[model samples]
Target: MIKNEIKIKSEEGEVFDKKQIALAIRNSTFDDDLRCSLLDDGILDKCQGCNLRYICDGIDQVVDSYVDKTTEVVNNFDFE
Candidate 1:
């Protein structure tokens, strides 16, 4: 794997590199709001009617904060 390459894993266990993600975003026909809505759909898909879905949703806020911190870390990372 290349150092400094941003990667995201999808719900289906597929990993996408930064360029792939960018390309998908660029090629997407959906508008920004729709895209955001799709994220909600994805969350629902992950939840799949689990009883703890609400708890997981609440934890998502913490995950968002962690992502912010991680983005900062990634921005300032020294691979050497």
Candidate 2:
């Protein structure tokens, strides 16, 4: 996978592509107290009872990439 890029593949070998996700994430603000939206931004917690918890590996990497990219974009902005 590309560095700092998020690539999620389905069980059928389909890659998920949503470009606007990065822009949306960069433009939005998240509260620290908000619930951790698994597979939305990042897998902040351990998997307890998901449908494909075992088979799905590298998910944490994708989540980290997305979060890192989003944070990078957001930090680079200087809204004055």
Badly placed stretches (over 4 Å) of model 1 are 1-48, 73-80
For model 1, residues 2-52, the per-residue Cα lDDT tens digits are 543456667977575867544443334234211233346665555466777
Task: Please report the TM-score between candidate 1 and the true structure.
Answer: 0.26
Question: What are the TM-scores, per candidate, against the unseen true structure?
Answer: 0.26, 0.24
Tens digits of per-residue lDDT, candidate 2, 1-80, equal 55343556679775645664444343334432222357566764556676666534444445556667666543565689
Please state every model's RMSD to the true fold in angstroms: 12.8, 10.8
Residue 1 CA error for candidate 2 (Å)? 34
Cα displacement (Å) at residue 27, model 2: 14
Find the candidate with the highest TM-score and give its number: 1
Model 2 alpha-carbon drift over 4 Å, by segment: 1-55, 73-80
